[model samples]
Target: MIRTGNEYRESIRDGRQIWIDGEKVKDVTTHPMFKPVVDVRARIYDLAHEEHSRKVMTYADEETGEANAIANRLPKTQQDWKDKRAAVELVQREAGGVVTRVGDETIGEMWSLYDGQDVLNEVDPRFSENIRRHIARTIKGDPFHISANTDPKGDRSKAPQDQDPDMLLHVVKETDSGIVVRGAKYETAAAYANQAFTKPTIANWGNDKLSDYAVGFVVDLGSPGLKFISRNGFAGRAPAADYPLANRVDEVESLVVFDNVEIPWEDVLFYRHTKAAAFIRSTLHRYSALPFVQRTLHLADLMIGSALWNVKQTGLEKQQAVQEKLAQLACYREGINAHLTAAIANAEASPGGLLMPNQSLLYTGRVFALSQLPAMMHTARELCGGQICITPDSATFNDPEVSPWLEKFYTINDNWVAEDRRRLLAFARDLLNSDYAGHRLTFQLFAQSPPFAQLGAVYRNFDWSGPLDLVKDAANLSEKVNGSL
Candidate 1:
């Protein structure tokens, strides 16, 4: 059965070991820092049950013969890719491109790909049915939020084992019921959304020395011995009133501490098989990138709309320079959308029968999107100019003394009120100047890999020479006809 938003909420109301500023959170739903994020996730659950989105958000799993979230259902054909894209768009629309973090969409897609695998038999034939059942149940009920724990090493040169062992999450002991894992997963996004889907960030090969760290499994959010440390509280600031876009769908990062946490045998997906580690990472790469492009499209739409609206409000719509700037924002949005559409159109079926985006194109898009994001934000900032920074707090307009003065000085076009114009400008400021703004810019810069590393991945994966060679041949033919002028 499809779980409702309230049901999902109740499931997580107890047993979570969440901390904000050194205090253990008694209730995540009511916590100021976590509540909005929770509300956003709850809306996703509501989408699954909505009449319009119910079909798109969920499908009948052939394995379990029950309806589950599309994120959990893997695609095996072109139609499946289309269906998955539809599901992604539905969620993106609900998020307004502002309320959900991009990582939530990306990591959720990765978890779906991971669950698509039939690795149960590979781990232990005895646990195949048990694992499959768990996977199906998880897909159907849990809106799994995944945090790719890849940045444990402060220095990039050191490997996991070479670094302080505690820097990476690893197994500490094995118990009769399960294995005890002790360590922390850092820079985890949406920690409060779904705690059960935590797994290793990289692949582990089970040599005698590394076998303890070779484990992968799912645990309850409120599992014994697990703890979460959040950087900020949700209620401390309001999104619309304070840091608009970032606060709306702010992605919270936390340290997931597993202090001898027991993960039952049935919950383990990979154990002792070093080879399967490669499979997990590769699978994630294939399925994760496309959904991000989906979310980016929504973000682009928001940026473009705001930029154009601000320009019009300022009466700069008639100015050629402003028109050109707006055009650039439009072009960027269109280009990104085109890339996403082409990637989806050209997707292929994987071995598991799930359709996945072309890795090379997806990777290229990821790099390009991140590179262009700052420029897009800059366009909005430039169009709004000093107004973004000068806009008074919403409360200022509410004050009788300041209201008349603010109205006289801040009014834009006759069609718009000074307060309305100020609100939009303030929204733009929150998006481009707030602390969250800085985090987003940094996140885009380092989301996948450093620029050089990303370029290397694109170069390694795509056949640049082949395309370049074709263009060269065409140029040579044209030169001969033109007498090398």
Candidate 2:
């Protein structure tokens, strides 16, 4: 059931509407902006079939004995999580950069829905089977799936009913086959992804059990009524040598307009059920956060390597202050490593019999990773020094007149040549100082959910009882203290 790279490419070229920078992209696989990322995604598929990666990237399904993506494998054992982590590390190594929205990260959103079958039953037992079927479809079909949650809310003060009814995606009409939804969601990689698990992002449903906005469904991105209007891409706007990461791994975000988009009955996961919507919103990132936070760990590695190499090249490693800063970066890197390791080490059993990373540790680790990201990046920026910004482009380094001057100034010693110096600075610039770097920072902050929501997850998952008991024992309080709170 695992698809090939070419097959994945052909699947997305299904006449889907995609527009960027005032021009319609003809073919995403061939477009200058999308091609690089699309090719990276394609390579991941190709990797699954390669000799060395065939085992790590894929597993034989117990029932069918068919090869399937290991990333899509339903996690039932701790070893499965270990294998998943190794597979992702292999991909990031192969890709030479980070690419988050492939398939594995978003598939967990469906697993969350699977865990919510009881909620699905409360609304409509018929749709409970929809989640199971869709989860299986993703594993067997091997589609490039993504997430859709954020809608362009018109006004925060007014309800979607009081404002433009289409502000939030809502059911516009009920057809014999399914319901037609109207509105748009901001989704990354939507233009090239095969499908999206569309749902509400609203945190509070407020007792409205049957509101129009309370709907969730599996949407085919290539549907006729779907329009993908993406923000301008970072790829191909500059020299790849100067902005390497951006050129290869910029996952373009789109405001996908669903103009009377019909959701076939089979595709609808839930309908007219506010509680169902709320349940999804709260638990949406439960399993997905593992991969999402795992990506940050890789980024930490990149930053540490870049900074350490910069210091080593400049012979600044002997300085104690510089050594301390490097140690700080290492601590940050290892902190994330510790969290990821412990999360799986203490894995928990889910209500649906699937294995889950310890929720408290996993969610708290996410907060630790994200909250410290900006500071750690700044530290890396400092360690890399100001050369990352002042360094000239590769063109000047190769220029006849400027080449000599750049070489004379940039070349440090026998170990570091001008070409090597230029490439390193360019990389550091793209990683920490460029427009793309800023965009990446912003994406990490808000992509999964906002900072406030991340904190809420920690609050909900952390066991307050243990701490309360410890305090009660320390203070010599009465046993009644247990019931007071």
Candidate 1, superposed: residue stretches over 4 Å from native: 60-67, 99-134, 154-163, 187-190, 199-211, 447-453, 468-485
TM-score of 2: 0.98
Clashing pairs in 2: none
Tens digits of per-residue lDDT for model 1, 175-257: 88877787876644545655444455653343543355555666665677867777874346654664555555666777777
Candidate number with greatest TM-score: 2
Error of 2 at 438 (Å): 0.4
**lDDT of all the models against the reference?**
0.66, 0.91
Model 2, position 406: C-alpha lDDT score: 89
Q: For model 2, what is the alpha-carbon lDDT of residue 286?
A: 82
What lDDT score is found at residue 29 in candidate 2?
Answer: 94
Count of backbone collisions in candidate 1: 12
